[model samples]
Target chain A: MKTEKGQPILNIRNLNIWYGDKGILSSLSFEVQEKQVTAFIGPANCGKSTLVRCFNRLNDFTPNFKFTGEILFKGSSLYAEQDATTVRKQIGMVFRRPTLFRGSIHENVAYAARISNVSRTSELNAIVEKNLRRTGLWNEVEGILDETPVQLSTGQQQLLCVARALAAEPEVLIFDEPCGELDPIETVKIETLMRELANDCTLIFATNKRRQAARVSDVAGFLYGGELIEFGATEKIFTNPQDSRTEQYVTGRMG
Target chain B: MNSLMSRPNPKQKFALQSIALLTLGVVSLLVWNVLKKTYLSDVQVSSVARVSDPVPNLLGDIYFFLSISFLGVLLGITCAFYLEEWLPETNWVRCLIEGQVSILSGVPSLLYGLLVVTVFLPYSGAFQRTQGFPPAGDLNTASLQVSSFQGDTTLFYIAVLTFVLLVVPRVIKATQEALRSVPIPMRESAYALGANRWQVLTKHVVPLSLPRVIAGACRAMSCALAVSALFIGIYISGYTIQPGRMSGRFALFLGAALVLSIFSSFLSQRYPLASTRHT
Candidate 1:
């Protein structure tokens, strides 16, 4: 894992995960620097999604998933001390396909804040507007927060998911292949949004596309077959590869 | 979607549709049989002693069956919600509760009535002095003694207890199904937003499914009213069935059905026709 910056916010130490009889990720370790965008790029079934899920304890929701490891958030064991519910408050997630509740867009974005007891109608509206604006969605959706998220375009839906996550005021924001299903334009918009979001919170993303990794993240980790093969500054890893497999992958030779 | 989904080779489907159409008349007939002759006739109430202007008969209900059944309904709904909210997530607890509900639903109302007669009635305040089915000579003494002594309150409440047992199973089953209809992601979203399991269930899941829960409860209410009315008349009211009381029983049945329809309309008004797309 790259460590050009100090003050790592999330540390995954020797995490091994299994789903029933099948081992998915083994002895994997990584560090996410505070207020920096870290992206894991890999091929299909390369365990990138599983890794991102580990960060926010989303992996626990998967049936039959068994894991043994310590994920430290801010120098304390995430699972040992903080329950998944509490840890998740500080770590938010955006799915690949936008998963929005069936409600007005305003309700969808303000869900987390409401659950966290961010009382006062004025404050909730302020949070909704600020997060939407930060995600570049406020202008597009101005005065139409009453509309359902289903009415938004695919691009706008993805950004709405970001806004919803942001309203939680999480210290770590995770995207599981945020643009995996989006068009090129939507992909670029999400990438730009991730870059902008890094200034406020630690960002970790998983993508199957190598170019998206190079475009969005400052630190890049290459995961293959449930193992992190090589990780470093994005430019150095792409320009001068450390591992043959990384070269093979970046050159479009083989996954 | 396409005129009964016309296909080049439609013989098998056509045959199935023909069979379905043939059964429609028979199914409607069965439904009509269950619902017809619901109003009490003179012959049906012939044994009942005729009485007129007896406190308006309160729509033919001689006993406080409606009030008692209402109390039973309140208790059933409260217990159902409590079980759902407080029960642990263990497999056996769920299985045990759901299994008992399934069994209880199949139980005959008479068996529940007999339960009230043989088991509950003995311990009721009405029988506080001479407990355990009084001697044959004391049978008349028992009813007269109890109702006269307690102002029919003991008999009324014991009958209500039987009604609650009948309702809890149906209400619990329906409420559980209603709660289950909420998607898993809805729960997961709440969890991700920092809600404990109980909070997620009560605040998010319960509110989303309230209409269905109430609808289920309304169904239980109708059944409880019908069954419990007949139950008390047979077991608790002694052999002297009054014509006014019998007419009141049928009226109560009709009122239950009417309430069900009203609840159905209220449900439609409160919530949009549900679409899977929302999930």
Candidate 2:
């Protein structure tokens, strides 16, 4: 497996998060290697989603949501006196269920770039085309760019969402259960796309599916009960896990 | 009773059916009464007429209704945007404002008119003083004299203010409902793409909620037109309609209601969720 070795893009130190006194993430300390797929594998409600939402400041919208942590993005603290919008611009996210805006397929792909102040029609078209091509959706949607995405299949919509996310040219992309709603074929496509995306962008793939985490990630962190039980190279974590909990989880004995 | 297809208790079922029928009957009678007054009644032409033709007067009334409703809807959209988007839903200020809107929505139109007469007209007296016009000679009599240029503008603005007070709460309620109907995930999607609050609203939420808002505005406008006519009949009868021309005034109100209802229904049918198709 190819790995991009460099300084870690994100460093989380003694992070604690809560939503209205219900603790979500507890003392998470880890580093995400730059330009590599880092998977956070956990069961449902294990704070994987919340942790990824933190990277983009998406959790700020949650009422009574608070976090005490130092998360460094390229050595700068993410929680410092900086605009959340600027942080989000650097860290894009793809959700579990596909969400498309109320516009044409072309418009959906161009939304991010447009919001970034790219207004020229040709420029938006190029960005949309490039991202769509990157996600392997260009051929399928080329003829019907003006059509609403409502008619697209679930898999197509998910691909369109990935394409939309890529349009902004984000540095780090987080996929929070992106394949939760896909069939096997669509799942394979998404997994392959994640591999291709890892070539250029740092990825944080959070999933309940352990096998998927093994398949896609260079580094894997096993989160159980809102705690990072183990973290290391994917191969070592699966074959020779340091923690008993990690052993039970990877071997399917426990969740 | 043991059978799955067994009928309900006969006495209870009969009572429910009778109540439903009675409600239907009452609603039908009310609708019929209004329709008769609107179409069948003779339009009495007054001798000392400012505008003899009821058509022009009807058109003028419609213009007034549209102006007031448009302003109300615009302000309501702004308030809804602030409440739903800018402010956190759990914020005390948002809750307080929402509660106030609910209370205002329930308040009767007469009370708004009373507010204009007691509070607003007296305040207009301040503006009159600043303009070097003699103080409104008599508050009550000056308010009634809507024909004079100065009094007419003041009264028009006061009427607008009153109708806006009446219409705004309804618009705010409708707009808020429209904004709420937009899925949270859609907004999160936009935010995830690095779009700020204003961009997310303009590009996503507003477009999604527009059809519903326009539909709501149509309903509010029709209600405003009909209710304002009734309000005028009660408060300033000498302004637009003579004492004996109640039937003609009723016709104008009913006409506006009918046209606006059709328009509202047309809007609802034409663009219902067309822009908001989710896969």
Q: Where is model 2 more than 4 Å wrong at Cα?
A: A1-6, B1-56, B113-155, B233-279
For residues B39-142, could you state the per-residue lDDT of candidate 1 as single tens digits? 23322222323233434334324344465446655665666666655554333454355445655776678557544543465445444444433445555544
lDDT (0-100) at residue B165 of candidate 2?
81
Model 1 regions lying over 4 Å from their true place:
A1-6, A19-22, A41-47, A59-65, A83-86, A101-104, A120-122, A146-150, A209-211, A222-255, B1-88, B122-150, B195-203, B226-229, B232-279
lDDT of 2 by residue, B143-177 (tens): 43332323345556667777888888888888888
Error of 2 at A244 (Å): 2.8
C-alpha lDDT (0 to 100) for residue A231 of candidate 2: 92
Instruction: Encode model 2's per-residue lDDT on A48-136: one tens digit a residue.
Output: 99899999999888877899989998889998955899888889999999998887999999998888888999999999999999999
Residue A123 of model 1: what lDDT? Answer: 92
User: What's the TM-score of every candidate structure?
Assistant: 0.69, 0.75
Best by TM-score: 2
Residue A113 lDDT in model 2? 86
> In terms of lDDT, which candidate is strongest?
2
TM-score: model 2 vs. ground truth: 0.75
Instruction: Compute DockQ for each candidate against the true complex.
Output: 0.27, 0.43
lDDT of each: 0.70, 0.76
